[model samples]
Target: MQGQHIPTDAQKDEAALWHVKRAGGSMSVAQEGEFDAWINADPGNRLAYDQMRVLWAQVEEPARRMSTAMAGEKPRFDKVRQWFSPGRAFAGVAGAVAVGACVFFFNPDMVENIRADIVTENETVTDVTLTDGSIVHLAANSAIATDFADGRRDVELLRGQAFFEVTHRNGDRFRVHAGPAMIEVVGTRFNVDYLSRNTEIAVEEGAVRVSSNDNPQGVLLGAGDRVAVSTAASLGDVEKTDPTAIHGWMQGRLSVRNVTVGDLVARLDNFASGRLVALGDVSERTISGSFPTTDVVGSLETVAAAVGAKVIRTSPWLTVIY
Candidate 1:
């Protein structure tokens, strides 16, 4: 039997149609005909359209209200709009006030001057070269804020992981801000993985200064060293290890050392080709192995066999363990 090919095109069309219909614009006869033809082209398209249509109906009012606000119009207090509008939901003036708050919170100079790469929820691995010839490899669910117009080059990693290969330049320092911890470097190659709870830094060459955003207490890390910062405790810890083993994900390898099963499953879900689930008492169990990010199922099976656990392939992209 042939394996199923995921309907990416159909899903994309469904999403596009949802946005079009939500904007409250009528499609031309030719356009509608073309849309119908496209939908009927495949059974999966119809199914995807149906699902998106349901979701469109649920958020139609809010979407319209947001559009109206963006257009700078006095929003109507229709019964449907009232339930979805930000004003009624959060006091009478909260919505407008929140917009002002956002403006104040975001630095005007930074917002206007900086050229930022904004990655949406679904986009994975956005790569960009900075003005100073530095290459930034942004991971999935990540964003980088930087300004190239200024004489100096600075980037703030809002969330997720990024690999930086900075070019050597005189009087230019490349800086990365991950949560409260800041990393400063010059002409270096390194990786920074900053999730919600943990901040990790591995230096491949040159050197980096890892410091807290709130204070001056930090440590300078050399090549082949790693540091982790815990946000919950606001403390930093350093360890000397093989940088390639920890930072191999940039090269398509998922390396883990004494990592818990729960953590492994979470990490695999981000970059793996399959959905990995841990069953039974595997949450507390630890795993120490290296695997390729391409073959998640094979890697999971190998790990499971090594640990004497059962590997159940629920589907092509879904796996359950026991």
Candidate 2:
């Protein structure tokens, strides 16, 4: 029952009392009402509230003095009232000093506390094997972050795509985070395509739960299933597709299925040295085919031939079609 007695309303009241006093006075009517309601709603609220109050008291004086200096006002006991005002006090001393101290003191800690791996645009595909014996094929222009703390392994997909061949590790959950959605799995082979506007999760081996960051109860996907989370909307649509086609990137192929011609061209441009442009009437066209990943020029040619579009190589870094 250790977790059962979390916190209570009376404890939160006591904490709020301290916070208001440290802020130079008691809570306003609106704040007091809000605090009371919050405490009454949860049993553990009071304990958590008291802890926060203690933290505030520890940092209150330094935060206040720092705020005063930034506002061009001398730090005095009388002017302490200025630190309690809405915009001037909070913005000037409390916020500035706290943030500045964090930036100055905690920067090194922050850098050392990084929980992810990154691959830049100029970098090639990197191979990483997780502690669970799962292999991650991280594509170029992609990054994966993993926090192996707190008895869980959480990997975040910052950009691009990655093919995961996960090893079966019982009791250990592997989660992939892309945008506002998180793909959770115990042990499964999957491909996460996280382009600029489209976030696609395709499962090949085991079942995976694809849930929105905003609403975790929305949807779940199984093996041989794909879910597309759009950047514009919160609703995600699921579809059944060939898992091989989705995993074709591992074999140096860019597979497409009814994708926009513009999107296909963009994919080609990522691997190729020059920019690939779609001419008039080609941007709106839909393309369905597979292109080789290693051969960017060949992919462009294949796409151009399929769409009857011309690929004019303007420069090494730029190209135009018309």
Candidate 3:
């Protein structure tokens, strides 16, 4: 065999795109390590990927428009050709073409710009161990991106929820971020939910402080304390909650108390791959129970009975209660 030279930057770009093509779905923990190693092999790989992420974010809106326009008319991709100009400015022909391929081929449902250590799909509850020996139990449809560097441990909750059990160290802060808010602690067990159209933090042990962009003053939360921060606005006062009852989803149980029908449906639909649509006048009904997350449809039936509504299943993909 002849001797081979080091790969040029363009060659690394091609290889990085190859990895990106196969990414974004569920993979085993070991596979995630291999993938991370490949991405970290060269600075060129990361630089190329940064360009792709920018292109991906730019394509999202255009993709949405194209999908809406194609719903009634014959399928057409020609109109999108002119839109490639934005991507051209960020990358070369190869990179621009990669963006086009993803825009037309991959899942539009996955809008998360995934550059992370590990990812879990909808309806899954999996656990991950970070470099510093901390454990995170990830909830359904959630994504976590972690960076443990120097004297700090930083993590981002891209979407959905996660319960972090941190291991303490002197002079270092373990921080979990959701939206614009940060939950900092020396060591503790806590859950963060980003799926409720806001950020919710509930602590089961130790204590943590939460601060947001708009409300930088934030609040201190002790064990059994919970709080909510509306996106970028103010955070509500801390409230007390039962940790075992609230975090029972780890045991396949969905527990709640005095929540409205709409709120219940939203929680159920998180575990369901299908749509759970509620008809009129069902939003105000208060619900309290322990329903199994493994059987969301069954739980929906229980909700229907409690709220005096009928369960209607048109297909496995759609369920309606009214």
lDDT of each: 0.59, 0.62, 0.67
**Candidate numbers, best lDDT first, in rank order:** 3, 2, 1
Q: Please list all clashing residue pairs in model 3, or write none if there are none.
A: none
Which sections of candidate 3 miss by over 4 Å?
1-109
Instruction: State the lDDT of candidate 1 residue by residue for 1-322, as single tens digits.
Output: 1124244543534443333332334456786777778778876666656644554455444433343333211122233223223322122211211222222233222432244465423225667788888998876545678766667677888766788999888857778877777888878888888643468888889899888855556789899888877685354567887866756766667677777765676566556433355544554578887876566677777777877776654323335554
lDDT of 3 by residue, 96-174 (tens): 2333334445543244534656767556799998888889998776778888877669999887678889998874789
Give candidate 2 regions above 4 Å deviation.
1-116, 120-124, 279-281
Alpha-carbon deviation at 117 in model 3, angstroms: 3.0
Q: Write the per-residue lDDT of candidate 2 for residues 6-54, one digit (tens) a residue.
A: 5543443344333433343334688678767866766566555656555
TM-score of predicted model 3? 0.64
- Assess candidate 2 and give its lDDT: 0.62
Provide the lDDT at 47 for model 2. 58
